[model samples]
Target: MKIAIIGTRGIPNYYGGFEQFAEFFSVYLVEKGHEVYVYNSHNHAYQEKTFHGVRIIHQNDPEHKLGTFGQFIYDFNCIRDSRKRNFDIILQLGYTSNSIWFFLLPKKPISITNMDGLEWKRSKYSAPVRQFLKFAERLAAISSDYLVADSLGIQKSLKKRYGKDSTYIAYGAHPFDNPDISVLDKYELQPENYNMIMARFEPENNLDMVLEGVVKSGDETPILVIGKHETKYGAYLKGKFGQYKHIRFTGGIYNLAELDSLRYYSTLYFHGHSVGGTNPSLLEAMSSQALICAHNNDFNRGILGDNAYYFSNPAEVATLLLTTKKSDNLQLVKNNFEAIKRDFNWEKINGEYLQLFEDCMARHQSGK
Candidate 1:
């Protein structure tokens, strides 16, 4: 099967979740004797024409110069390019900037959109932008040939909102094993002596609330706040929490090995993403055997399933940090690791995507 993966910055995963998904899933598709192409932004670090066996299509992207509006132009370029590719299927990873171009998508290919989290509900966007996102969500739902939800909560939400049935396929992660202890030396950290979070600096991530909880915990243990601290929100968070001696704002670390080692050695891994479905970092932390304290929500709960700690607010976050012990939740960590291997493992997820693609192709061919 010939497939085109759209809606990500591009492969080798220099960015966030969907890029990671494209990097892993597209390689797997190529390995299985299928032709796969991933759309990359012109400015993406990986400038090669292909990654592994998968083809890379670099489209003109001006997001840096134009800001968020640049993404719309990038998506338009990609959609316009896809019209001539004659792909069997185009798997769109998200709809925020791309859904508006649904009318421009080629008619020959079956379009399968991975309906990502509730973007309209994010706190960062203004009322008008949120309303626009909601409308884009509807356009994506109605325009695609099929829909995919990354979590059961998202699937249910899609059904409730648009009466659309979507395939429930959560994100995937590789189980971390044989973590290198020496990696901790670079960060001047010892085993189980610190806590951490690895997520983009966004309001919906609840970073400030989690940090406030950490401050309230009064443990004085150094908590490494990973992710880039150069953004507007990041600077605000730094100004808010920099006075706390234990709160260290380490900029983004993209190395998976370093991140895995960090999580494996941490005392507590706080996942404060309240607005997304099945966050990739949460899965990574679980796979690394980190004792998780996730934001209380259906998405996190559906994935963790009593295998980790839950917190709804700053107070809950403080309580968990103050009282939870790594020794006590060893079994919970083990259970989450097992869950990663059994359910969220990459091979299993890659196969599921393949099956979904095949099924969609069959249904489309049959005119069903």
Candidate 2:
């Protein structure tokens, strides 16, 4: 089947979870005898070129710096070009609020969108933007032939908000083989020496809570926070905690191997995201076999099952840090790994998407 992926900052996954999801699924779909094309941001120099048997179509506003506006331009250009292509299905990863072009597309081409997380609930957005996002989400839910929810929590949200039935396909994680010990020494990290938190410095991620909790805990163990220092919140975090000897802020380690090594050897993985559904970092941590401690939420519980430790208050987090034994959590990590392999492996998850696309196409053909 010929398939096209729209509404993501094109692949190889340098950015967010959607990009990574597109990257993994595109490659898998191509290998499975499906022709795939990704909409590349025009700002990227390589946007005009094809990579790994997938065609790359460039969007007018490629910088992706324009936030929601950029995605609008991307979807417009994609829809315009899509009219000329003989694609069986068009998969959109996010809500396209600015582009009315999607509504113009030929209804015969099956439209499947993964609604990602609840973007409107994010604390970083302004009141107006949040309201706009809520409206956009409703439109996207109603317009699409098929909708995908990344977690059960998100599926529930969709049902409650729009009364739309959504397919629940969890995000998949790639397991890291035995990481190189030399890589650990390079970061001055001995196994179990530090707690690790890898996420964007956004308000919804609850980074401040993690930092304050760690400081209050007074545990001698260092906390290594790794993510991009590009945002205003990121700069604020660095300024606030850079002076502390126990808090090591490595701003965005781009090297995949190095990041995997850090995750594999970490004593405990800290996930404080209070919003969003099935965060990719948390899944990656579980895949790395790190003993997980996450912000207590239905979303995290749904993903981690009984294999994770959760905390609601900063005081509770501090208590866990001081009390939980590193060695005792090995079984928990092992159990998480087992569950991830069984349920969240890309090989299995991607096939579900492929089947959904096929079903959507079949339904369209049958005039259903």
Candidate 3:
């Protein structure tokens, strides 16, 4: 089977979740005797023509200069190039920008879209932008040949809103076994002596709420704010929290090993994402044996169950940071790690995607 994955900045996961999925799954497909192609931005760091036996297609990406509008152009270029490739499956990772160009997608390939989170619900976007996102969601749901929801919450919402049937496929993570305490040397950190949250500096992620909790707690224990802090929101957060010596804003660290090690060693990992399906970072935290304190919502609750503490606001976060004991939550950490191994391992996730592609191909051949 010849498959092409679109809708991410590029592979090797320089960005985030969907790119990570593309990096792992595309390589797996190649290893399994299938030809896989991943579309990368023309400016992506890794400018190679191939990666780990998978073909790499570099498309013109003007996002650096045009901002958000450049993403639309990049997706358009990818789809236009894909038209001539005759791929058996074109797996789109997200639809915020690509859905508008669905008409240009080749008719021969089966179009399968992974409906990500409800982007329209994010507080970061303006009202008009949110409305546009909602329209994009609807377009992607109806335009694609098949839809995939990364979480049951997303799947249910899709059914209720669009009356669309979608496959419920969650993300995956590898259990972190190599815990090098030495990785903390550069950050001047010790094991179990700090707390952290790794997420984009967006309003919906509740970063400000969680940081406020850190301040209110007044524990003075170091709390690392992972993610790029160069955006306007990032600058605002830095200005707001810069006085606190413990609130360290470490810019984006792409090394998975370092990130997993940080998660493994942190006393309490805060997950404040209020929108999104099974978040890849959250799963990585779970797999890395981090004792989590998540934002109380259906999405987080559905995944963590009773395994971690839940906080709805700054007050709850403060209370948890002040009172929660790492020793008592050992079992919860164990449970989350076990969950990753059992259900969210990369091998299992890769196989499921392959099966889905094969099934879609068979149905297409039979005119179903």
Candidate 4:
């Protein structure tokens, strides 16, 4: 199958969730003998035309100048190019900045879109922006050949709201059994001595709430917050909590090895994301055996199940920290790790994606 992947900054994924999905998914499909093309921005660090067996198509992305608006132009170009290439299928990773150009997508190729999180529900966007996102969701439901929801929660939401039946396929994570502990020393960290919180600086992530909770927990153990701290929220968090002696803001560590090491070594991992379906970082934390203290929400609960400790307010967070035993945390960590290995395996996810593409193609051919 000749597949063209769209809606991400593209492969070798130095960015976030969808790009990471494109990187692994495209490579796996290529290995299975499917000709895969991933769309990349011209400003991407990796300028190579191909990575692994997957082909990369670069386009002019004016994101630097135009900000989020530039994404529309990028998607327009990608869809325009796809119309010419005659791909068997086009996999759009998300609909945030690209759904407006759905008319440009070729009619011949079956288009499968991953309906990511409930974008309109995010707190970061203004009321008007949220309305736009809601409209974009409607457009995506109408335009795409099929829809994929990463979590069962998202699937149910789609069914309830749009009356659309979306395919349920969660994101994948590589289970790390043996991480380089020496990397921990570089950060002045040790196994089970510190806690970690890694997520983009956003209100939807409950970053402020979680950070305050950590501070209120009053533990002498350091809490390492990892992410880009240049945003307005980031600055707010620093101003609010920077006085805390135990809180260390380790600004945006992108090294995969370092991330895995931190998760593996940390005594507890706080996943504060209250928005989104299946989060890639949360999955990675599970894979790394981090005893999770996730925000109490359907999305986190769907993935973590009984294997994690949940909290809503600072008081709950404080209580959980004060009461939870090390032995219990260890047991939960082991269970969560196994769950990740069993359910969120990359190999299993890639195979499901291939089958989805094949099924869509087959249905398209049969005019069904």
Which segments of model 2 are wrong by more than 4 Å? 45-48, 62-68, 96-100
The lDDT for every candidate, in the order shown, is 0.93, 0.83, 0.94, 0.89
Off by over 4 Å in 3: none
Instruction: Estimate the TM-score for candidate 1.
Output: 0.97
Best by lDDT: 3
Models sorted by lDDT, best on top: 3, 1, 4, 2
**For model 2, what is the error of residue 269's alpha carbon versus the real structure, in angstroms, after optimal superposition?**
1.0
Writing each residue's lDDT as its tens digit, candidate 4 over 171-196 gives: 99999988888987887876778888
What is the overall TM-score of model 2 with all chains considered together?
0.95
Query: Which residue pairs overlap in candidate 3's backbone?
Result: none
Among all windows of 10 consecutive residues in model 1, the one with the lowest summed lDDT is: 213-222
lDDT of 2 by residue, 1-368 (tens): 88989887787776778888888889888888988999877775465467788778877873347775766766778788888888889888888443356577766578888988898999899999888888888888888878999999999999998899999999988776678779877778787778898888898888888888888898869888888877899989888877788898887887777877787888878899888888888888888888888999998999987898888877878988888866888899888888778999989899999888878777787889
Clashing pairs in 4: 227-252
The clash numbers for all candidates, in the given order, read: 0, 2, 0, 1
lDDT, candidate 1, residue 111?
95
Q: Poorest 10 consecutive residues of model 2 by lDDT?
A: 96-105
RMSD of 1: 1.2
Models ranked on TM-score = 4, 1, 3, 2
Please give the distance, in angstroms, between residue 71's alpha carbon in candidate 1 and its true position after superposition.
1.2
TM-score of 3: 0.97
Tens digits of lDDT, candidate 1, 1-368: 99999999999887889999999999999999999999999999999998899999999999999999999999999999999999999999999999999999999999999999999999888999999999999999999989999999999999999999999999999999879999989989889999998788998898988998988878788899999889999989999999987899999898898899999999999998988788998999999999999888888999998888888888998998789988888999999999999999999999999999999889888989
